[model samples]
Target: MNTGAVLLYHAAQLYCNLYKVTDFQAKETAGIGVYSALSLINHSCYPSVKHYFIGRSLVMRAVRPISAGEELTISYIKPFQKAKKQERKILLQRYWFSCTCEACVNDWPTFPNLPALRFKCLGCKNPLDGRPRVCYACVTKRRDPDKPQTEQMEVVDSIWRGILNACCTDLALNIGQKKTREDYLTVCQNLQLLYEHVAMPCQHVIIMHQLLYKYFEDEF
Candidate 1:
């Protein structure tokens, strides 16, 4: 081969070595193979689509609704969480590109759907000023002839713990194998619904929201 042809051959080999066969399902590394079409898909932290191995062929699906004319993007690494600006720059170094996705652009805020950290009162569902024994809306109710202050607070606390534990348990179980996009998204969305139902923001709920945003922000 001519020198130019020889150089081209080595470059192709190196590219395959770096980007080919992302993972092994069974126990054989020899099974690694690359596809030209699959290689063309670019990397994004907030990908609109996802791909998985189906036997020897690859299948791609939209993880979220996509507008016409929008680019189809997928992640080359685990991407369900936000990272610091510097951290993102470091992570993108492997792919050799600068990211300007919404997360990167905004320095990774909680996904657009979830906007605040304020918690609601268990009694009246109003936002709390700070941690308190009683909310403004509930103060009068607690003082009524039939309602006792201590009893109401205890009931609210019990209900809150139960919801939080259920959410945490469901999320942990779904993080394992056989988990699907629906599985993870359901837990995340349910947490949001629970917050709305209770009319309160919680530390654990906020953390779950953040985690969900990190991984599945593009989904919804």
Candidate 2:
């Protein structure tokens, strides 16, 4: 028999004995006890089969149900932990295909440092110097600039309220209902506007776009 046929035969025989199903056959041998017909099963970054060894006998079980006409798949490696680029490169060489998994595709990007604010002295409204025991102007008046200024507080509270209101309104619209294409598109547009107006520049916009893309793509 050809290599493919041999592998299939072995896989069928092994599957039958392992699962106690009697209808399987091994038609070919591929290496590492992997049979040809079974080797026809493809690799998925996310796989249905859980590959394991039972005392040197290769065993696989369905992690999820397999449907008719669906290609059988097994993972090339562990799912959760992050792997170094070099490690992935070596694995891809062995597998003979480039890894196009979500983890591989979405490598994290660096974020910028936060904006700095000037600290002011309460008594004179002057910028504070480094490590001063007390502001010279504030010491004589027994005033503390560290306390929240009422005007500043009011402005901050108003901005916070506006953001909260927008968020709550969006949640009400989207939650607990089947969203239509128009509804999803509207939400994405709204979110894009809010992020542009409110969030700092150089912030991660890709995450926002990805969230919208996932829902829209799933619809299609």
Candidate 3:
């Protein structure tokens, strides 16, 4: 190849190496290919569409309804995997474009708080009442000295129970050959919420992460 042709070929190869996403299964790399036109799509932490393989062809499916004139977007990164500011800056630097996506602009709360959200308070050993600031005993007790420490637990417990029941129902329905990718994703999403909100360490949290891991292994 001529010098110019060699340079262009190397540039294309580098682009593919850096930007192409892998489609995998069972912890093995299934295949890799470029979606040249789909690469034109912008990114959002909350994307309107999802792109995956249907056999050997790439297909884009709307995860939700879309309206005309809306700019098409796909996520270049996972949700909550990085803090908003850091992710945005990294995207801008890597892609040479600033993200004006709704999630970035609105400063949505990422799952960066999962560790705090998933465990009990260091002090008092009770549930961290809300937002992982401190346990009810450590903070609320000063204000409502007459109120029982378990008072807030009632509301949190009710919410956890409701989520647990819904997840169980969904799991039961999905037990057979009737389950779809969407259903599996839905279950994992709920379990993620349960894990984030349930401040007590429970076996269910481990199960939730396991189910999520299985879904990702099989599908992503």
Top TM-score: which candidate number? 3
Instruction: State residue 215's C-alpha deviation in candidate 1, in Å.
Output: 15
lDDT of all predictions, in order shown?
0.55, 0.45, 0.54
Pairs that collide in candidate 3 are none
Steric clash count of candidate 2: 17
Q: How many pairs in model 3 have backbone atoms within 3 A of each other, for residues 3 or more apart or on separate chains, i.e. clashes?
A: 0
Tens-digit lDDT track for model 3 on 4-23? 99989967655523343345
In candidate 1, which residue ranges exceed 4 Å CA deviation?
Answer: 1-31, 80-82, 109-220
Q: How high a TM-score does candidate 3 get?
A: 0.48
Q: TM-score ranking from best to worst?
A: 3, 1, 2
Candidate 1 on 1-220: residue-level lDDT in tens? 8999999987775553343332324324435666667677777766776665545656676654467999888766545354455766786776667877655675544333444445555567776555555677767333453343344455445545655654564566567624346656555455545555433223444455444433432232
Q: What range of 10 consecutive residues in model 2 has the weakest lDDT sum?
A: 18-27
- In order of appearance, the predictions have TM-scores of 0.45, 0.29, 0.48
The segments of candidate 2 whose C-alpha lies over 4 angstroms from its true place after superposition are 1-32, 55-57, 64-70, 80-82, 107-220
Candidate 2 RMSD to the correct structure = 18.2
